[model samples]
Every structure is written in C-alpha cells, then in structure tokens.
Target: MNIEYITTEELSKRIRYDVRTIRERLKDSVLIEGIHYIRPFGGRKILYLWEPIERDMVLHSGHHTLAIPMANGGRMNG
Candidate 1:
C-alpha cells in the first residue's frame, strides 16, 4: 500500500504551532532529520513521518522533562 506523507505545515496544525517554529526550533533539536522528516528524492522539500512523530509524542508526553540516568544503566528522577 502507498503510505501518505504529511508536510511540516500539517504537523504544525496538528501540534498547534507555526510551521516556521517547528523548522527553526524543533527541527534539529527535537526532530531528527531522517527519523521525523526527509528531503524527497534528495530535494529540499521536507515531509514529516506522522507515525514516528505520534509515537515519539506518546513516548515523551509526561511531567518530567529530564532524563536522569540511574546507576543501574537506566534512567529515573529523584
């Protein structure tokens, strides 16, 4: 099946932020290049993969914004 691709504009609308903000603020810091977005056919146009974005949002949606590494080779907050 041919999967549908979404533009940064679409992601902005879903996340309730300006498209420019995503590119300027969250593009490299939060959203990795190939993981969250791509340049189609080596072109400059960027398309975001919605599935990964949704999964990451779900995975990270929480109270604590810190990633405290535990001594047991894991992570926790105190």
Candidate 2:
C-alpha cells in the first residue's frame, strides 16, 4: 500500500485551507493522528496522510445537516 504524505503547507494548498487553520483548528480536531496524520519515528514533525483525509472529506461533504462528533467515534446528528 502506498500512502501520500504531505506537509501542512502542502495540505493547505490541496485543501484550500490556511496553514494556520490546518495547524491550529483542523489538526487533532477534524483530522486525527494516526488516521489523518502521523509523526514519523515519533518525532515532532507531522506528515498528513493525503488519501484518508481526501476520502473523509468526500464522505463528509455535501451534507446539509449538522453533525457533531462524539468521543465514542459516533456522531450526534442535528
């Protein structure tokens, strides 16, 4: 399996989000570690996994209703 790893700057460009937003808002909130990103060798540098993020973006897109994510990995639809 091949994974495309990208930096925060690259992710910002691909997702059309600001670098600060990705770093501050999205990271560890909407995008999770080990799922959407990883710290290689347990270092401080973060590399975002492109495929999972893209897949999730498409999956969650086109929704008119609001859904809040729960801590148990479920969503509370609103």
Candidate 3:
C-alpha cells in the first residue's frame, strides 16, 4: 500500500487553512491522531496522511447535519 505523508504547512496550503488553526483548532478535535497523523518513531514531529484526510474531507463536505456527541459515546445528528 502506498501512503502520502505531508507536513502541517503543506496541508494548510492544500486545505486553505492557516497553519495555526490546523495545529490549535483541528489537530486533536477534527483531525485525529493515528488516523489523520502519525509521529514517526515516537518523535514529536507529526506527519499527516493525505489519503485519509482527503477522503474524509470529501465524505463530510456535502453533509449539513450537526452531530452532537452524547456522554455514552453515541452521536445525535441534528
């Protein structure tokens, strides 16, 4: 399998978001660890996986639903 890894700056350019926003706002909330990014060799540097991020962006782009997370790990779409 082939995977494309990208830096935070590169991702900011591609997604048209500020690097600061990605790092502060979206890092752990929207873009999850392991799924969206990885710390190579357990280092502090984070490399994002392009394919999954792209796929998720496309998948969620058309949705107008609001998801509210429940305490029991369920989500309610409004």
Candidate 4:
C-alpha cells in the first residue's frame, strides 16, 4: 500500500484537530511512533501518517471510550 505522508498542518486541517493538540496531547499517547508517525531522516520534524491516524481518529473519538493505551498504564476512554 502506498502510504500518504502528512505534515502537522495538513493533518490538523483534515481532522479538525489543532496542530498543538496533535503534538501535545495525541503524540506518543494515542499516536504511536514509527507506527502512526515518522521523522524525516534523523530530523526533529515529525510527520504524522495520514491513513492510520485518520482511521484511528474515527475509531477512538468518543466519550467513555478508553480506546487508546496511555504510557502511564492508563487508558483514554472518555
């Protein structure tokens, strides 16, 4: 499958989520590294994977939905 690479702004636009939210709240929490996102050739810039994140955004956007695993041994349900 040909994966689509998306920058922060592009992703935020499509999902209606703020870029800051994606970077601050979602990154490394709901969004996993190397799975849902990737950095450019040793660069600090992280580009989110469009397809997977999109799918996940739909799947996990809800109240009382502990869909994603948190790093602190907790779940993000609601």
**Model 4 over residues 1-78: C-alpha lDDT tens digits?**
888999989988988889999899988998899989999897999888888986776777653354678899767765
**Tens digits of per-residue lDDT for model 2, 1-78:** 999999999999999999999999999899999899999999999999999999899888844458888999887898
TM-score per prediction, in order, is 0.73, 0.78, 0.78, 0.70
- Estimate, for each residue in 40-78, the C-alpha lDDT of model 1 and write its tens digit: 899989999888888898788853466688789876855
| lDDT string, candidate 3, 1-78, tens digits | 999999999999999999999999999999999999999999999999999999899888855467788999877887
Residue ranges of candidate 1 with Cα displaced over 4 Å = 63-78
Better of 1 and 2 by lDDT: 2
- Model 2 worst lDDT run, 10 consecutive residues: 58-67
In model 4, the Cα lDDT at residue 29 comes to 91
What's the alpha carbon RMSD for model 4?
A: 8.8
lDDT of 4 at 39: 93
lDDT of each: 0.85, 0.93, 0.94, 0.85
Best by lDDT: 3
Tell how far residue 18 is off in model 2, in angstroms.
0.5
User: What ranking of all candidate models by lDDT puts the best one first?
Assistant: 3, 2, 1, 4
1 or 4: which has the higher TM-score?
1
